[model samples]
Target: MTEQNENGDFFLKYRNETLFNDKNSIVQCLKYFDKDNDQSLDLNEFEQLLKSLFSHNGNSYQIEMAKIKAMFDFFDSNKDGKIQLIELENFWFKIIKPTLFPKNALLIVDVQNDFITGTLSLTNCPSKHNGAEIVPIINNLIDTVPFETIAYSIDWHPADHSSFIENVNNRKLAENSPIKENIKTFDSVIYEAYPNVLQILWPAHCIQGTNGAKLHADLKQVDAKTDSLGRSVIYVYKGCLSDIDSYSAFFDNCRLNETSLHNDLKKLGITDLYICGIAADVCVAYTSMDALGLNYRVIYIQDGVRGVDSDNIKKQEINLVNNGALLIKSKDVYDMVGCKDRRPELAYATFLSLARSNKV
Candidate 1:
């Protein structure tokens, strides 16, 4: 910030209020989000930026926002239903240190209903895992972290499509065509390309207005429609492609037309990303790997994560540590955010155009 001394000498001091000790991460996180040119970073811009960091196909504007109520539960440390700079910076320091927040801090992964319900789970073909442990941990984490911004990914599908078995059934009966459902009974099984369909077939779920598509009971909305604290949250839609699956919220995994989640994160000056969710071996794994690839420090909490156990979660954790990522637990998160936030301010341009009416 620009200031003058008693001798009328002007000089520069703190430029960014979002300052942290880490040169690679926290310090970089402050480079863009300090909006007021003040000497201390606040929560206003920080929270907003975290919500809208990912935009795939620029259609994020059309995404469903009903699931973002948890964002406020994380960022509003005071439990007063409102977030100010004081409330935000305080919790941030608490997470980085330990013994800083009024309580503890945490981050959550996908807890939506479509993935948790037995009928809605992607692996519906006889699987013991139902995304239960991951759901409760996410719920509990939200309560612990103050000023925590929540990012949820919803898998939306178009009304009429070849992705669903029902849709395929309808087409078979029409136009004097008969494509049987069973293996031997089929006249001809159309070899369609669906990267999401693993070798097995399961009932279609998350078809827009369907109940299975909503957030799970354990992951219920904070206050019906709005966030529990009445704060705004950002919603991102993934796996919109009828031809493929997008397990990772960061990208579609096809790597064809990627969104700027990294850039949005950089703009918000987020140094550390904590990831957890259902299908720890799939979506959660893919997202954590991608985040580290972008040079972001990450902590993957085992308690906050669940998986189909197809690939052994333990082995996956080892892979993460090998790639500059940390495999932590729910309890460890509290120590990480216990006391490591420093509030600095950045100087930026604020143009003001004033208009006055007077009679001369």
Candidate 2:
């Protein structure tokens, strides 16, 4: 590395000056901040990391940008265009630790197969582990809501899904983790399996035949029986868009999306929605909030949903309550809509208490 100082003295030296007071921390921090495929950082990228650590009041994306920028300035001492791998070990890694640890926030973003099983996720999703308890609650909720229809966000990939390992052509064309790889996100990936430059995407995980790709077995039986599903029940599937990440049944994240649920609910004269699903902190929480925002009376069954982390659960629960979506345990609902003759396992009087509560 060579550079001309402010005094116009030209000197060439190594970047190992402050890489470490301790060697282990240097190696770890360098590995953490280096996200892009390239080994070097630019000024903009270096600031992104720095801003995140110091600036406590910003969104995740904002913090990410700042962190990226900070890396750029710290390593590119000579004003060079690119940073070498060794330069990262010298100066940048030292200050990067306090920057990388995430600040805790309370919000439910989604609970899905991709998240529950680490097959296709980078977050510490809490709901996946609690699947055992959450599933039965969902089953009970489904049974109780006899008149209402259900909308599902299933990732029904084509036989040759662009995201699958089976599609060798896609694997070759796409980078390991392309920014817009899925057909749902970028419509171009669907028809032409082989693209010019697919981004570096996660390794092939959720392709069709893979066990990690299938929906929960319980949801599958119900999904399979959709045609046989009660006439009163309606099902809408989202996330079928090859390039998009469809979290909500109503719309894909990237596109202006809509579903029949709203119109169908209006048809049935139902203004209230009992929203519950996997990963209470994520998709289930997001959908309920959107429902309340849309002026639908939203009721999120607490016992019926699960989150990936304690922090996610705490955040999502608060969001649900603030949005005017009533949060209740599963037993609470079973008691409310439950028939007088057909009682839940609980005592009859307990049922009345929930049924008569404000949630209804």
Candidate 3:
């Protein structure tokens, strides 16, 4: 069982603490994970060690296998594919203790079935956005990356919501002669709630409790039950207000009202956010912008996101990088995270473009 201090804070017990704080523990753990009993650990061996360490004593933190592999690469400074015993010892004291012990959150935006394969499927979307392709990537991340908090931003809308083209078409059909005037999908309509606000009507999707609103089968679900450390996955429903559309996880499009996400993160003491999900040009872009505005250092996982419009997405990427969001490939997450300076290395042209762009 885990141990607790006098103040009721949970921590590693004396025996466990000594094991982690010393080099012998590293050597022992390495041997246990090393299936061949070799002094060096391969990718599979390294991954098993990570899973064991994090899940030890019912800690219940989910970590991605890829990040574990990345961690291994960082330790294998000799550029060898396998991690030597001495390399494992160096990692425990120099990297792992300082970098990953802090509080962090992983924010996944709109990985629902609707965005993947439902009416609003990005596969054949206007920009031919293949949103479904991100599922396996994200699932892998969920399985391997360890974070204090896991939050999901779901686009839940009522059937009569103003953003639906069907509702707009129905209203228009009633007021106009069908033969003379017909409203089609993707029609733009102005709602009186926010006058002059252009509401790009989408196919009705993610209605409250519908199957379309559910998360994709491949995505891992955090248990509703909190672990011993008081950690569990959080679900934040946005775009529920009938009149307005909410793209950012923190607030509506107009910023009229905010979601519980900001307060929740604040309470959790989350200083950094790792963001990934579907529709990069829209939801992911907006969420990254808001996170930067909120003073939270944002890291955009490039491989873990898909775009609805390729052109728009390229522009959005430039804009996000300019606005202080660090762009990184998913593989770089483990190594890059070990440093206090999180600025990503960029080419001259990329930096210049980012410096000039103001909007996503």
Candidate 4:
């Protein structure tokens, strides 16, 4: 039989072995699977337990023996070839619970010196919002919440970056470019290049190794390594290529190149991304949109973000909400992260993720 058929047969046989009634506690469920009544589950019994967990509401997850073996070994913490009630309890709380809920990450996007007070300061932008105002708000969240992962994205552009107004003459403008002659900052222009790109012109800022490229001094800088709380800190640098501009921390504007943010978050099993930062209409909006596209539950912290254009920020908020992102305030984050304020929208995101993986 083919592997698929074999897995299907296995599911058919075990789908009805155990029913997960709402009243059944973990201990009770373990006893139900312990057919031998030895207060422990052998590999076969453990497989049935996992099968039951994944099979629910007219869906049966395809079981892979190798994956099952690995999980079995992990939960068999003592390596006794069998999982005791205690080991099963650990599995229930640590693995199963989080799977049903979600693992969260805080993504702080491009809150740098240049955007706050240097050359490209938002105070000079259309909205004239103080970018520095978000620093303390983000810092408070960092200090209070025990997020599983925290990522900070920076605009690490090169001196001759195409998005910079000074370099507008370096590249040939596309024939279809809306504005070619007398190009000015904040004007949208199309470049004549492979996969012709449309770019917004900005003053030269965030040049590599420059002081403006540095994150704001007061912004909390968590070490880019695993901490004692098992939390991971990551720094994502975008717009490094002199040719292309990158707004989303995950991918370049043209989607030609990808930053390590996606793979890094995947490695940590990040399910939900709580995004907050500068330029809500630009980088922050792009990052949040990309996060939603990647199947993450996105929560946009409204007050924790500052934007360059107030009108565009409002439009971005509407767009994000229409695309399954939750618009929330910083005040509501604590309860949400602790899973005390379980929003149905977030739960729906979790369900959609499981459904896409064919695990529902």
TM-score of each: 0.53, 0.45, 0.63, 0.72
Give stretches of model 4 more than 4 Å off.
Answer: 1-100, 194-196, 224-230, 350-360
List runs of model 1 lying over 4 Å from the truth.
1-107, 122-127, 159-202, 220-232, 259-264, 340-360
Each model's C-alpha lDDT?
A: 0.48, 0.45, 0.69, 0.80
Instruction: Identify the superior model by TM-score, candidate 2 or candidate 4.
Output: 4
lDDT for each residue of candidate 3 in 1-360, tens digit (9 for 90 to 100): 222212221223312445558677776667766889778899977655554444323232344555555566666878879988787777565444433344567899999999888988887676877777777777666666666788999999988877787777443322222222355666655555565456677889999999999989878777748443345577889999887888899999889899999999989887668899978988999999999778676889988898788888889999988776778788755544433222312211222232345211
lDDT of 1 by residue, 1-360 (tens): 122212110101122233332343333334444567552344454443332221111111121232222333454555665544554454334332221122221234456666676454635523456676566667666666542445555655555444455455543332322344453211233424533233222346566767766667767344425556432233556556664556676786566545445555555455556787766776688778887666555668777776755556777777876665666677655535432221110000000000011100
Error of 1 at 338 (Å): 2.8
**Angstrom error at residue 15, model 2:** 78
- The best candidate in terms of TM-score: 4
Q: Give all candidate RMSDs, comma-separated.
A: 17.3, 24.2, 13.7, 11.9
Q: Model 4, range 115-185, lDDT digits (tens) per residue?
A: 99999999999999998999999999988888888899999998999999999999988889989899999
The CA lDDT at 356 in model 2 is 40
**lDDT at position 222, candidate 3:** 72
* Number of backbone collisions per candidate: 28, 63, 6, 0
Clashes of 3: 6
